[model samples]
Target: MKVVVQRSKQASVTVEGRVTGEISFGLVVLVGITHEDTIQDVQFLAEKVAHLRIFEDEEGKMNRSLVDVGGEVLSISQFTLYGDCRKGRRPNFMQAAKPDEAKMLYEAFNEALRAKGIKVETGVFGAMMDVKLTNHGPVTLIIESKEN
Candidate 1:
């Protein structure tokens, strides 16, 4: 599992002119799953994102976690995160998990976040989506279960 986490002031995802998910003062998490991913990967990433201390505290230090800030999550299924571009100009998605398996792990990740007491929103899996966000502090991080 690979996740691109961005702190957003506000964010929304639109699928076919309809908004699927939206959030304010939270994180927009782009999630990618590989064939090797399992429930363990899902569990690790969800807990990490929930507790990441990317938000600022009263002293203007980045000391607050999503749980402390009462932030939400806009989770999007993003197989493109696994795009391998080491060869030629074309990116290969062979590392991305098949849709059926990816979807199950994706849902499980979201459930894990909810279990940690964070409100979560999501984009339509396998749908063409347009995501918009105002990145707070423009803070972004890429987390991978393979590294954990």
Candidate 2:
């Protein structure tokens, strides 16, 4: 499992001109699952993102976690994160998990976040989506379960 986490002032996802998910102030989490990913990976990432301390505190220090700031999450399933471009101009997506397996893990990840009392929103899985966001501080981080 891999995730690109971005702090956003506001964010929304549109599928076929209809808003699927939106958030006022929170993180836009692009989640990617690989062939080797499992439920354990989903559990690990959900916990990590929930407690990530990227938000700034009163002293202007990045000391507050998403839980502390009461921030929401706009989770999007993004198999493209695993695209491999080492061979040629066109990316290879062999590293991405199959749709059925990926969808199960993706939903599990969201459920884990919601279990933590976080307001989580998501885009339609396997749908063509247009995402918009005002990136707060442009603060972004890439997290991977395999690294752990």
Candidate 3:
């Protein structure tokens, strides 16, 4: 499992011209699942994301977690995170899990975040989505379950 976490002032996901999910202040999480991903991976990443101390505190230090700030999450399934581009012009997506398996893990990830008492919104799985966000501090991080 891999995730790109971006702090945002506001964010929204649109599918077919209809807004599907929106958040005023939170993180935009782009999630990717590989064949080896399981519920354990989902749980780990969700916990990490919820408690990540990227948000700034009163002293202007990045010391507050999402929970402390009462922020939301706009989660989106993004298989392209695993795209292997080392071979040629076309990126290879063989590393990405199949849709059925990927979707299952993705949903579990969102649920895990919600279980942490954080408001979690999501884009439609397998749908073409347009995500808009005002990236707060442009603070972004890439987290992978395999790394930790």
Candidate 4:
């Protein structure tokens, strides 16, 4: 499991010219699932995302987690995170999980975040989505369950 976490002032996802999900003053999470991902990966990533201290406190220090700031989450499925570009000009996606399995894990990951009392929104899985966001501090971080 891999995730690109970005702090945002606001974010939204549009599919086929229709807004599917949106959030204000929160975190925008781009999630990816690989063949080896399991329930443990989902659990670990969800917990880490929720407790990540990217939001700034009163002293202008990044000391507050999403829970402390009462922020929302906009989760989007992005299998391309696993794209392997080491070879020729084209990238290979052999490491990405199949749609069926990936969707199941993706839903579970979002549900896990919701269980933590955070308002979670999501883009349609397997759909071509246009994501828009006002990145706060342009703060972005890549987290991988396998690596940790």
* Candidate 4 Cα errors over 4 Å, as ranges: none
- The TM-score that candidate 1 achieves is 0.98
- Would you list the rank order by lDDT, best first? 2, 1, 4, 3
Worst 10 residues of 2 by lDDT: 139-148
**lDDT, each prediction:** 0.97, 0.97, 0.96, 0.96
Give the top-scoring candidate (lDDT). Answer: 2
lDDT of 2 by residue, 1-148 (tens): 9999999999999999999999999999999999999999999999999999999999999999999999999999999999999998999999999999999999999999999999999999999999999999989999999974
Task: Tell me the spans in candidate 2 whose CA falls farther than 4 Å from its real position.
Answer: none
* lDDT score for candidate 3 against the true structure: 0.96
Cα displacement (Å) at residue 25, model 1:
1.2
